[model samples]
Target: MSLQFHNQLTHRVDTFTPQIEGKVSLYTCGPTVYNYLHVGNWTAYIYWDTLIRVLQANGLRVERVMNITDVGHLVSDADEGEDKLEKGARREGKTAWDIASFYTDDFIKGMARLHLLTPQHIIKATSYITEQLELVRTLQKKGFTYQIDDGIYFDTSKFPSYGHFAGLDLDAQKAGARVEFNPQKKNPVDFALWKFTPQGETRDMEWETPIDLLEPIVADGLEYEQANKKMGFPGWHLECSAMAMTLLGKTLDIHTGGIDHIPVHHTNEIAQSEAATGVTFAHYWLHNNHLKVNGTKISKSLGNGYTLNGLGEKGYSPLDFRLFVLQRHYRSEGNFTFENLESAKNRLHNWRNSAALRHQTHDRLRDDDEKSTDDESVSLYASSQALIEAISNDLDTPAACAIIDEAFRKIDGINLEDIHQHALTSFIETVDNLLGLALFDTSKDISDDIKRLIIERERAREKKDWQAADRLRDQIEKSGVTVRDTAHGSIWEYVA
Candidate 1:
């Protein structure tokens, strides 16, 4: 089956065909780098990672771009609150620059721990200020932007397709305006492209506005003029549009983000991007559903947010969390609990053990010159085909995982002598590439001390010295290694 994705733009599962043949331009919204990324934040990355793997598995060269929003993400979607980075800085008693640097590193480390592939281009919003300003200038010249007391705002009324992606009711929104109803705004739905710095207040991160871009405005029967040299920052939605277009191009094959961005953030991106360039912004739009905990949204305000280190403190590896995420489809809402996480942990452990046993059996039996019979080859081919079919169908990860479970059961039933080493190796590598699980890793070099201890423990076991064997086992475990006594011999692995 060919790969398909549920494009949020069309609200349909469409077959994916890149704009350029043999190459796919993909972009995913990265973290704001204001604080440590919680599990909820990680879920979006996992979904995008799976998408990238699926695309590459289909033999399409992918040029993926993810942005690190170091600045310009306001606390509220209305773009009326403090910058998230600046808020974080105030909360942590650090400079905004320090906060961004620290959190960006932390986010990258968490991604590495979860085995997420780094994108081809990871651009920071602060690094692309020139591009963002240029984009704002383009919108102003195109007569799609208006200036207010706060900053430059996009005139959503001018863009006929405003809120088309989200199905927003412009008249209804104006009637039932709940918050951030700026009276100076020509329309309540209009959003800021750049925000002016507050009077008599200095900001650590602000850029001087271009003198020639100011336009006159009339408010409350009085003529007002925009500050030509005002210091301000870009808006949250502006950064994504600028960075994505700067790196990927005017149009992208796929644009991905959390479902929460569907309403205002992504809608504004479409309005401004299409308004500036008289073409479609992206071919496909994909969003992952929210990750909840204890029946509530995982947020810092709710005190339900969790980080990777928090999981480790509770005795769960990052891959265990990854497994938990994959057990459910990305488009479905997943509720996380310790019980569910434990189940995923146990599943991962069993799968890893089975894979190790298969490797050991393959090493013990097949000779270098031996080849598999027709039956073995057929079994391997069937298992591989099942996995491919499962993953290719809209990234049905839960189905793919079930196929893995079935493959392991089949492996357990087959005799080691009948399995072909080359075929088994190829199958295992393909599975790893598709799943992003380090299942076939056996590259750890055991130290001489641990090896000698294992040997002594084996001798003690053979001599019926249970007490000495138990003591040696404890010592080996204290050295951060786990030992399992099998019928063939004892196997040791590092404690993750």
Candidate 2:
């Protein structure tokens, strides 16, 4: 089957076709780098990473760009709070640039620990300031931008389809607007493209607001204090559009982010970008749902925003957490609890043991035996193909995982010598490539000394020396290898 995804733009599961055949241009909304990312913040990244893997598995060359919002992203989506980086600086007693640098490094390290594929171009929003200004200029030239006291704002009224993508009720938003709303805005749903620094206060991150963008301002909102070069910065929505179009082109094959971005952030991206280029900003938009903690929304006030380090502190590796994330579909809201995580950890442990079987069976299947395939041989080969197909159908990770579980169940029932060595190895490789679980790396062969101990234990068991066999089993486990004495034979598994 061809690749498919629930395209949020179309609001349906659509077949994925790239703008250019065999080449996919993907843009994923990256972290704001204000602090260490919590599990809730990381779900989108992991989901998008899976999308990249699935695309490559389908034989498509994916050129992906992810944005690091080192600047312009505000504490509030309403564009009324401090820049997240600046706030992080104040909280950590560092400069905004220093905060961005530190958190960006932490984010990258976390991605590595989770085995996420690095995007081809991970651009920082600060690096594309000039490009962002050019986009604002384009919007201004097209008569799609207006200036207020705060900054340059997109004229949502001019773009009649502004709320169409998000299905936003502009009339309701305007009618229910609070009295404290910014009356200077032309429309209640209008968003900032650039934000000016408040008067009498300097900021750690600010840029010059071009004079041309300041002209044609509102009658009551025109005030320039810096010799026609007011200090400002790009809006949170502006950076993604600028960086995405500048790197990926005017249109993208796929754009992905959390579901929360639909109403404000992504809708504005569509508005400002399409108004500038007169074309669809992205062909497909994919959104992953939120992750909650113990059935509550992840919140710092609730102290449920668990970071990767937090999970590591509790003795769960990043891969274990990755398996936890993939246990449910990406579009499904996941509930995070230690109990749930323990289940994923155990599942991963079982898969690692199954992965170890390949090391035992390698180089043992005869050529003649390969010609006469057994049920186990066909099962392993078919399981690998089924995994790809399941993931291709809108990234059905849970289904793909179930397929592996079924194949491993069969492998568990049969004799180790009867296993198909070549098919088993290919199946493990497929699991690693598609899931990024690094099963092979974790399931290495035991040392020669440990192998000898296992042999001694087997000999003791054959002679019915129960005491001696128990002693040898203890010795084998000391080396982090535990032997499972099955009816077929003993299988070695990693202890932790």
Candidate 3:
């Protein structure tokens, strides 16, 4: 079966046929290193993670790249807001670079805890300064850029398809009628390529450009006194365009980000990239819906979102939240609440306990000499085969989740020795490889001592020592291993 996805570019939901056979190249806009990543940011990543897992499970080799926007991202998509990194610096009392370094490490650690597979390539915008300048030069030479009081601006009016992805009327875009219209822009939709550092201002993070220090030339719908030669910064949109060109070449297979990116950030990327390359920028465009809480967005400024450290301190395992995210599709917005998270946790614990039960049943078979595989092994094998079918069908994750849940519930019904072995092994290996659930990792394997305690707990239950068994389970859990009780046996997993 072939993979399928809803392509925003064509406005059609179609099968995901890659440009190259058996290999998929994808680029997701990663979080800007402004502060610790909030749960909202994580939902996007988790969505992408599921997509990658589903693709890999369908036997498609994926080459994924996620960009780290350490610089050139503004608090406002209108290109008139404060730099997010600079804001982080002000909040942390450190340099922008330091903040980027600090939080990037934190983000990586969070993903590790969640068992999210890292991208094949991580491109940082700050590191691509030379590349950014060259791309701007390319646009300049191509007659796509014009000098404005604010620095170089990409003349969105020049591109007939300026609002191509945005599905906005070109006339409405040019009329200064949109939100946050700057009176000084020649066209309301024109966006900054490079910002000339404001004159006479000592910016801690200014770069000297090779452009001439000249007097201001043009004015706009509304303007005041400002020179184009003053040192500023690179505008947000140009950074992604330049970085995407450098890493994925002039064209990309797919470009992904939050739905919020569709109107401005991604719109400008298409303008600049296609203007320079004279071709379509990306074949498919995928956007993840927001992870909203209480019908509003989660942002650091609002103090409404949770970071990994914050969630971890509250005793929520990172993967539990990751599993929570998988309950919905990438294009679907997921609700956030303590109730939902608790429900997801229970589901994960129950699944683990079922696996443990299967393992114990296998052990009993080994001892009985009648020779049969456990219920889990059989159920997993059946589920693994269905996993591919679900994933290939536009990554039907919710369906796959249901199938997995059913397998967990029906493990007891599977009893054939040879059949059970084949099914269980197949299920654990294939679905694990696809979902990135870390079910069979050597490092994640439970220690023997904890396993022994878990088995003892099981035996205690068998002996009808209910209180003692519960106490033993608690003790084992307090030792940093989580215990899950199943019909077949008790199982434990190490917590980080």
Once fitted onto the true fold, the runs of candidate 3 whose alpha carbons sit more than 4 angstroms away are 173-181, 212-230, 300-302, 363-379, 413-419, 441-496
In candidate 1, what are the lDDT values of residues 100-198, reduced to their tens digit? 999999988888999999999988999999999999999999999888888899999899988889988888988887664588888888999999999
Q: Of the candidates shown, which would achieve the greatest TM-score relative to the real structure?
A: 2
- Each model's lDDT comes to 0.84, 0.90, 0.74
lDDT of 2 by residue, 1-496 (tens): 5999998888899999898999999999999998989999988888888889999999999999999999998887767888989999999999999999999999999999999999999999999999999999999999998888888999999998998889999999888887746799988888999999998889999987777777643344556454466799999999999999999999999999999999999999999999999999999999999999999998889999999999989999999999999999999999999999999999999999998898777545555665444667888989999999999999999999899899899888566778878888899999989999999898887888898999999999999999999999998888888988888788899897
Candidate RMSDs in Å, in order, are 4.0, 2.5, 5.1
Residue 153 error for model 2, in Å? 0.4
- For model 1 the local lDDT of residue 240 reads 92
Comparing 1 with 3 on lDDT, the higher-scoring candidate is 1
Q: Which 10-residue window in model 2 sums to the lowest lDDT? A: 216-225
Give candidate 2's whole-model lDDT. Answer: 0.90
Q: lDDT of candidate 1 vs native?
A: 0.84
Against the hidden reference, what TM-scores do the models get? 0.88, 0.96, 0.85
Predicted model with the maximum lDDT: 2
How are the candidates ranked when ordered by TM-score, highest leading? 2, 1, 3
Model 2 misplaced regions, further than 4 Å: 178-180, 216-226, 363-373
